[model samples]
Target: MGLLVVAALAGACGYTASARYQPSGATPSSGAAHDPTTDPASATAVALSVAAGAATETYRTDIGNATAAFVADIGTLQEAVDGGDIGAAKSDELAAQAQYDTFRQLEGGNAVNASTLDELATEVAPNGSFAGLHAVERDLWTSGNARADVAGLSVQAPVAQYLLSRDRLTPEAIGTTAVSELGWVVSTALPGREERFSHLDAVDIAAAVGAADQAFAAIEPVGRTVDPDLTTSVAQVFSSLEADVGSLGPPTQVPDAAIPTTLRLSVSQQVDATAAELAQLAARLAPLGTAGAPSS
Candidate 1:
């Protein structure tokens, strides 16, 4: 059962959100074209580009691993539940709780990069629509703690519940169902809100943020559910929690009510999407592996 929880965490951490960028006709000019052999600026530019590229790749890989770990943990928890190993499930829950705490600490410790934010704003300024919203969302996740903490919290709790309720379903069945539901939440429900919030005005953003806060507050009870509700209430709570957190002021920003409303909306939407996916994954544990296979 402990092993199963570990697997679910791995799966959650392994879950990957698709990159929002596309190839453009305009490629970055090679340093050779600008004589990197002699021109210091060109040489420096080339070096910086290489470094940036490497960093980006590393970050992407880390994010992917984290996502996979999270999903695996979920799978493990479901298995524990199916096998009726409540003690093991509780142990897994403790492990997940520790990980989530660490994630929050890491997230809170890091500061948002000004240059990254500027770059995101620049990229989105041209699109000024859903594309822009997505750009901001990507940028937000690129910041280490922001993505990790959200994903950690989103995957941990429900899995714990599933494990505690192992008497209700088969391990394989629970695992399969959880993964499938997560896929649906990510592909459909989350993206839908992103599109909707992309069009919000400043006042609208504030209202949405407040509403999300209230909704999140209402969900405190659900967290205690040994057999939780994984319907729209869960989704609503997740959406609200995401929005409330995402609407927080940037690391270095002037205090203006309207400033970054669009960006806030984007962040909120992404968070909401993540939360919804978590709930969906939890709910689907009922139909995982009814046959002879182990929980994937």
Candidate 2:
């Protein structure tokens, strides 16, 4: 890709501005010396945005680390396989797969360039371009060929640089994305499709769930300030969902059916409940930055 195309790829990820705030004029304006205590809604809106911004920074940092680690792991896997250390190569492959899952959501929105990186990192393409993580995985686990030029594959620098250039996801976007991510985890990721060859579905689930929780945490303080009861409920349900995931134990190398049906049902239910509560929270917070309420 050219320099311009690479630069554009920075915005080539999945995400939309879901949290839409009303015009500044909609909220009651305070004078320069106005106190936050006098304008609770406006104050809360600012707090929410600030909290989201801080969390976005942290998330970005984590993504940077994950991307770097993934690249390094892929490199190590290549070396291990080249050096004929099959056991060490398999371990490295699993670690690399988990690291990629850590930031997979970022690829949710980059349709234009998504396939470019996906092809490089995964075995999705039928063409001969499938030469990175998944190809190596197949070789190690299934194909037994164990020969893909992983040394030449490059996904880290572009992904990391793109993150640096991308703007922070707004509070509204984060809320919507979190709900969607949870839903995806329960609906699709749990079935073992994400890490099919490695059978590391648990790793993908844990990473995704952790990210959604982080997103919710960013706006949660504002939610507490506005609706403590609902916030508490959200927190509790999230805790339950996390515990359910934890019950699955370590990442496994088994078929999807090995996971109990009952646990899957339980996870699905918790995900539904969490999504409902989170959506309600998003709706409630949506208007807080808008027209002021009548004085009680």
Candidate 3:
């Protein structure tokens, strides 16, 4: 998923609602783009495009708010650590982590630069600089409980703002990204890879699920217009997946091993099912001249 920081650029750059969707290897007609009023596909495409645009704006705002709160919490944590208040530092760190979990998807898909988010909340900086949320988590959890270097760890705000400025808010892009994200949640996050230090993998997993659900919501209405049955199936699968994740219970500080194996397996299976349904949804949206087709 770390690669997402770079991969998302393809979806976030140089996109516009007016672009025509031509199938691969097909040449455009001599006339102007197909008229949405007369073409069913074009009409569906336009509607989905508009919905995606609106969803993008909402995401930008939500992520921006989360980033603001996260930065503030980090500052308070730093202050507490410097003041030798370990309890206060731990509490502040939890607050910061929770805020980041709410909008961590922004780190992957909308970041203007690879290092912009990494420098703030990454587990390990490519440059070997051990800073950011994970660094603080490690320090707080360690026996030493010492202060971590929290200088220059607030670039998340500008990254959130970057989403607002970029225009790649299309149904195809969001759907495709959501499918990939859910795959990661099932394979990596639920397996205890994320939030290893803080034992907060449940929080991260739930956040990813929520983000995927929101992505689906953005496209589902148009999907129903295009294919009602497929949309219903997608919604049903999402409901099951959300229920399985909820079974994990609320976010608490518990080691991955402490979580029951049966429940984890159940959630992982449901996640795969949900991603499959979303991929189908994306496929249905592709031919409507609004979204790109999924790659295989």
Candidate 4:
């Protein structure tokens, strides 16, 4: 729904969370002796233990805190529109968009919240595919009659978008979802007009990557335990990806000449490479491996 807190911006300037590291019990890559007759049940238990710990403790807290912030921003946007002050509405819309950049990304790929919000946006906005932030953005950015006080009156759609995931959000599920969202960013959102109405592709791209990082953080310890080389590679690649996106400046302005588009082609290539690494990591962890691949 919003940032993990009002304290700092994870997306706006390519802010990053501190990486949490845990020691790996068995170092398999060093030709270390394997456990004698590894039991299937024991392996399963370990995986489940890892997932449960990550999901419940880290992932849940991040998403839950952000949800509260997003809900509050939504209220601000609604109030501005209700007042019929286009100036105030524009300011609130931009503020709301900044938060929505991260909120939408937190959902990962085609989440129920993302889909529902589109319908809700259409219900209260002009013709288009994106009805949420973009819809309200149109009224703020456009000229003449097109720029009017328009936004969904109800916050139900957005509220649901950020909160429903609490009860049963497995780290494996979230990891896969994060990979899917990242794939889209490289293949479509970054190159294309993701936030066409707001011209905020840079913002969205940064937010999407940040969201992936959050999901990846939950599983990083497990990844390192399984394959330290692979985990290290993922971390390096992620650092590069964030730096590339972060350099694009803010959503309100055009990107640098080097990255005339929201992201440079080289940046897109880096994402693909990162996806391959994540796919390998996920395969070792769970069936979520397929999510890192481009959709057929």
For residues 226-288, what per-residue lDDT tens digits would candidate 2 score against the true structure? 567877888999999899988877754434666788987887788889988887665555433
- Given candidate 3, what's the lDDT at residue 40? 31
lDDT of each: 0.33, 0.61, 0.62, 0.55
For model 1, what is the alpha-carbon lDDT of residue 139? 25
In angstroms, give how far residue 58 of model 2 lies from its true place.
3.1
Model 3 ranges off by over 4 Å:
1-49, 79-88, 91-95, 98-106, 109-127, 143-148, 155-160, 163-167, 287-296
After superposing candidate 2, which stretches have Cα over 4 Å from the reference? 1-49, 116-132, 145-149, 160-165, 253-255, 285-296
Cα lDDT of model 4 by residue, 134-222, tens digit: 66666566742222223452445455543544333344445666677678777656764555555656665676778777777877875
- lDDT tens digits by residue: candidate 1, 136-206: 23323343122332233344434432322222222222222333333333343333332222222222223
Error of 4 at 60 (Å): 1.9
Q: Which candidate number would show the highest TM-score if scored against the true structure?
A: 3
- Candidate 1 Cα outliers beyond 4 Å, as residue runs: 1-40, 98-296
TM-score per candidate, chains pooled = 0.24, 0.71, 0.72, 0.68
Local distance difference test, candidate 3: 0.62
The CA-based lDDT of model 2 is what? Answer: 0.61
Q: What order do you get sorting by TM-score, best first? A: 3, 2, 4, 1
Tens digits of per-residue lDDT, candidate 3, 155-238, equal 443455444344344555567768887987877689877665777688768877887887788677766665678788889999
* Candidate 2 displacement at residue 207 in angstroms: 2.0
